[model samples]
Structure formats: structure tokens, C-alpha cells
Target chain A: MQIRPLYDRVIVKRIEAQRTTASGIVIPDSAAEKPEQGEIVAVGSGRLLQDGTLRPLQLEVGDRVLFGKYAGQTVKVDGEELLVMREEDVMGVLEADAGTTRKAA
Target chain B: MQIRPLYDRVIVKRIEAQRTTASGIVIPDSAAEKPEQGEIVAVGSGRLLQDGTLRPLQLEVGDRVLFGKYAGQTVKVDGEELLVMREEDVMGVLEADAGTTRKAA
Candidate 1:
């Protein structure tokens, strides 16, 4: 199903860790911690507030964001992992200027 | 530490469960599902986007919101469970209708 997040909602595809690391050893899924970040997938239009006004969002798709451990409902689209959440849920987009970058799979 | 969420960031304190329940039998921590929502605490002043302007937030404190599971970072303030997540992380404010009023502890 094509679940479109309306009104400032964003869909994110979480980046999965290729392999588990523990003291330079590889661990299995049964022992690995769930990844807590994701890449933006789909985004929503701005929302209309209480004053009969509209508020625009600053974030865009493809931005990687960090989230709380227990946040966002899980879903899959076209066999891809995804999470549907509000644009506000995105704690912050990780700046690309930092050395931290998404590892290529 | 006072974690002020600037620029549309919101701090949420997850409401905890009073007693467990299941088929009339009380379930313990191991079986109960973690509540995937929280009450708004701190808020950011909204962000300035690429267009060099500011945007306002729509939600407010005391508004219970639903978030995707595995969203936001975990933090504690004054011995209370708090989460510093982006306002965008809030999937939606749970509408207070259809008998979904939270059971008071």
C-alpha cells in the first residue's frame, strides 16, 4: 500500500547495519541492538495550524535523522523497511559536513 | 541537565503504566508493550530553513502525541523519563475522542 504521510508527515527508511560489532567480532541479529536512525523517504506538505494558518517545514527527503529508541511505527513498502512519522519527530538532520557519513551498503 | 530543544524540538515525558494487565491477569515488565507516546515538555523556537526564514510549530506542551517506535533519544531529567526528539518526530497528536482518554494512574 502506498501510505502517503499528509501534512508534514515524513516516511523514513532506516539504514540497517551491515554487520554487528563487538570487540572487533561480528555478532548476529539475536545479539545486535536495533539501529536508531533513518533516511527520509517521503514527506508531507506543510500543516495548517489553529489560527487558520499554514506552517512550512524545513527538512527535506534524503536527510538522515536520529530518533528516540522507542519511536515511530514500523512498516515496509515495496520490500523496503520504512517508518511513517511526523516531520516534527525528526530530532535533527545529521549535517554532512561532519566526518560521519552513511556507510555505503 | 536542562535539555532545551531548540528550533522545533520537543521534550516528552513518557507516561508510565500503573499496573500490568492481560486476560484479567497482570503482566509484568517482560510482557507488557512499551507505551509508544508521550507528553510534550520542552520546545524549540522553530528553525530557519534554506530560504533564510523561520517556521513555527503546531503542537504544544501537555498535548499527548504518538510517535514511531524507535524514535528520539532517551534522556532523564529530575528522575523522570524524558525524550529529546524532534518536533517532526511526533507522528500525530492523538485526538481525544472515541474513548481514547488516557486512564489516570
Candidate 2:
């Protein structure tokens, strides 16, 4: 049972936060806010425009993305929790191995 | 004090829901969910891509749009509540008049 999003939508798996803080103190699950980071799993083809052309999305699979705390809907797919949101919900994508320098696409 | 969102962001004013239901029952504000419909008040310049090119946004000012329940950040601007979100948070745009015909640009 594969789930595919419709036009411009994306499916993402949340990246769990590190259990310990920088100070090496364990942050309890109850006190921590939901993680706002995720990795793209699947994406829609594109939105169909008024002129009958598809406007391609900016996000791609495997991109590590940051989103707002309240962005997207949570759904249980195959017993795993996942988020489904539009490409615009993504604030930015983290670059690979660069420390910083995020790209908002 | 003008509020302009940076790159691919948008400012939206929520469209208030009708106070009365179809059965002429008046609904109280406490029981109503925040309206998901909005009108584009302002838009940001296109996002800067990795190749240093601007990818223009699909949303435009004056267009009516739909969004998810927790799409954007709410801010007070000139005593009015406004939502600031990226263009991707917009699900679709409602066409003007003629009954129905939404364009998802």
C-alpha cells in the first residue's frame, strides 16, 4: 500500500530530536516540543495550472527540510506516523555536511 | 510600518466564516474553528535557488486561498491579525464569481 500525494503535496518522515542536549543532560520526551525537522519521502508530480500546464515543485525526495511547528497533517501510514504537507510548508532544506548554509526552495 | 515577508512568504487576512449556519442557527465564536480561507494581502519576492536564480511564486495579491489548519504564523499588524506563510502553504486559489471553478496555481 503505497501512498502518493496529489499535486504539489509531499510526504515526510519526522527526524527525532537527540535525546540529550549539548550539556549532556537528557531531555525528557514529555517536556520536548514536537520535532520540526523531516526528510522527504515522496512528492506529488506538480500542480496543474490554469493554462493546463504543470508547475513543478521545488522540493525533492531525500531532502532534509525544516517546517513550522504546526505545519502539515499527521497521519498513520502503515502504522508509522508521517506528515503530509505542501511544498510551501517547508521553510528550508539543510545542505549536506556544510554545518550551516540552508537553502529555502 | 509596512510588513513585507521575505522570499516566497505571503501575508494573508483570514476570511471570517458566516455566523449563521444553513439552518439559520447562529454559531458562537468559541465553538468555531479558525477559518482556513484567506485573501492574499502581500507576497514576497521569489525564492533564491541554488543556481542563484529566482523562482517566482505562484500566489498573487487579491487571490483567495485555502490552507491547512496550522499553516502559518499569526501576527498582529495594525491591530489586525494576519498570517505569514510561505506560498507552498496555500492549497489552492478560489476563482472569482461564476459559482465555482478553483484554480490551483
Best model per lDDT? 2
Error of 1 at A16 (Å): 1.2
DockQ of all candidate complexes: 0.05, 0.03
Best of the candidates, DockQ: 1
Off by over 4 Å in 2: A1-105, B21-25, B96-105
- After best superposition, candidate 2 residue A23: deviation in angstroms? 66
TM-score of 2: 0.49
Highest TM-score: which candidate?
Answer: 2
lDDT (10s digit) by residue, model 1, range A1-105: 677778867788887766745567777655777776678877777655655555665556777676666667888777866888776666655543521222211
Model 1 RMSD in angstroms: 12.5
